[model samples]
Target: MTYCVGMLLDKGLVLMSDTRTNSGVDNISVFRKMHTWSIAGERVITILTAGNLATTQAVISQLEERNKAPSDRRPSIMEAPTMFQVATQVGRLLRDVIEGRQDGGMQGEGPRFTASMIVAGQIRDMEPRLFLIYPEGNFIEASYDTPFFQIGETKYGRPILLRGYDRRMTFEDAVKLLMVSFDSTLAANLSVGLPFDLQVLERDRFDPLHSRRILASDPYFHQISSGWSEALRQAFHSLPSYSFAEDSTPSDGAR
Candidate 1:
């Protein structure tokens, strides 16, 4: 249904999410899958969503409403004291919305309320942190052994990250690796399409360093896609050739 990745590096954080929603072969549309809340020079938080659109929207809407109310409610993400508390609030809200909607009181066959999110950011006095929240309200943080998180149609694009990802890599290299990873996923999954959203938050800056939307017609994305495909082809062709000159198997080889 989507492709969202949150990569934690020594430098900061890189988050990207596709903007495609597909219900059937003939039903397709674009909806932004990334949302950010930031108080420049104070704190920043980004959320990437995947799964049932209604459920995700409702959860976000509820949070936004709470933030806009009479100022007596809990602080919004922009005012949160810690990234962990922000994530905790969001996870609880998501679970409550899904469970409330699934009680089957409104009508028969209640609308599917399944969704997950990747949340990342840094508080003014804390280090950058990244988290992946599951549909059930539980979450896990990025660790040294696995410094990245992915949700939705992730299998296709995951291999590149597995081979190239490292906490020591620079921000520029991390962006390139993610572009390839997203490119691979785009090529293989119909449910995930472009108009990608990316955000980079440098460590301890308490602000976003870079944020942009990449459209389907963007030249850089096209170049990355084409270049990666060509590189793969060349690598395949360069592999050592193993041929049987006499059409007879070697004694050490399987018969």
Candidate 2:
């Protein structure tokens, strides 16, 4: 399992993904789930993946190979005219990879090789866009109604995003928001362990404004985790206390 978020903000895209994979408690491992490609000043693309690691890796490897030696028959994301086209290409590739695996005898009652991805980025002269690509090659875009996408181990961290996301928030605030979300997830799920990868892409830049790995030793993330816990406790206590007396007047039902 993993956790990855691609947020659409007025400033551009903010993306993060955890680096943990485990078949069992004793067989845990770390693997990067974030992948990016760019053409300097022309375009920049980022993908956050979740699900079957083998399927995800195969999809990413094919994209990398295309980028390295793009041909007319096998076009690269860098050549895609728009962010939408780029997303379409990625979705198709991801679907093809998973289907190929299923055809190779990894089907029936065994573990299904499926995966999902969040594709976010911008092309020259176009606004940044965000997409959630599923194993079936279908996808949806982030819009005013849904300005973000989350894949993998999402339930634990979704509430934080629901309450805190803002379209006009600063990049600094966005990262802080994601940290709290990831921290909540990490506390609850063993399969989503960190050393998270983060990237902030400013509008029209065609390159990442900030990129780094948040390791276990990262002081800021530690602070965010502990501080958020304390804050939640304080907020819970501060809310109006539940009063049994207020609920003791159920005369209609009792009668």
Candidate 3:
């Protein structure tokens, strides 16, 4: 399991993903789930993946190979004229890999050979875009009403994003918001351990504005995690308390 979030903000795009994968309690490993491709001043694409590791890896490998040797059947991501086309290509590739596995005796009824991705980037003069590509080769784009997309171990962290996301928030605030979401997820799930890869793509830059790996001991993430816990505790206490007087036995006299 993993957690990956991509936010489409007025200022730009923010993407973050954990690097944890585990098959069982005794077999745990860390593998980066974030991948990026860019042509400076022309285009930049970021992909965050979750689900069946083999399936995702195969899809990425094929995409990378196609980029190096473009064929008529498989167009390179770099050749896509728009971000939408790039997403279409990725979705097709992902579906192809999963379906191929299903054809080769892998069960299709469950998560076996299934994977999903969050795709975000910009093309030259086009507006930045974000998408969530499902295992079925279908996808949905981020919009004003839903300015962000999260994949993998999503439930534990969704509430924070629901209450905090704003389309007009600055890039800094957007990254902080995502960090809170990731922190909430990490506290609840061992399969979603850190460190995390983060990327910021400023609008129309056609390249990453900032990118880095956040380690377990990262000071800012630590502050965010502890601060959120304290804030939640304070908020819980500040809320109106329930009154028990009506339900009480009226002091054994007024009843």
Candidate 3 Cα deviation (angstroms), residue 217 = 1.2
Lowest lDDT sum, 10 consecutive residues, model 1, at: 246-255
Model 3: what TM-score? 0.93
Candidate 3 on 90-133: residue-level lDDT in tens? 99999988888888876655466689999999998789999999
Minimum summed lDDT over a 10-residue window in model 3 is located at 246-255
Q: Give TM per candidate.
A: 0.90, 0.94, 0.93
Q: Please list the C-alpha lDDT of all candidates, in the order they appear.
A: 0.86, 0.91, 0.90
RMSD of each: 3.6, 4.1, 4.2
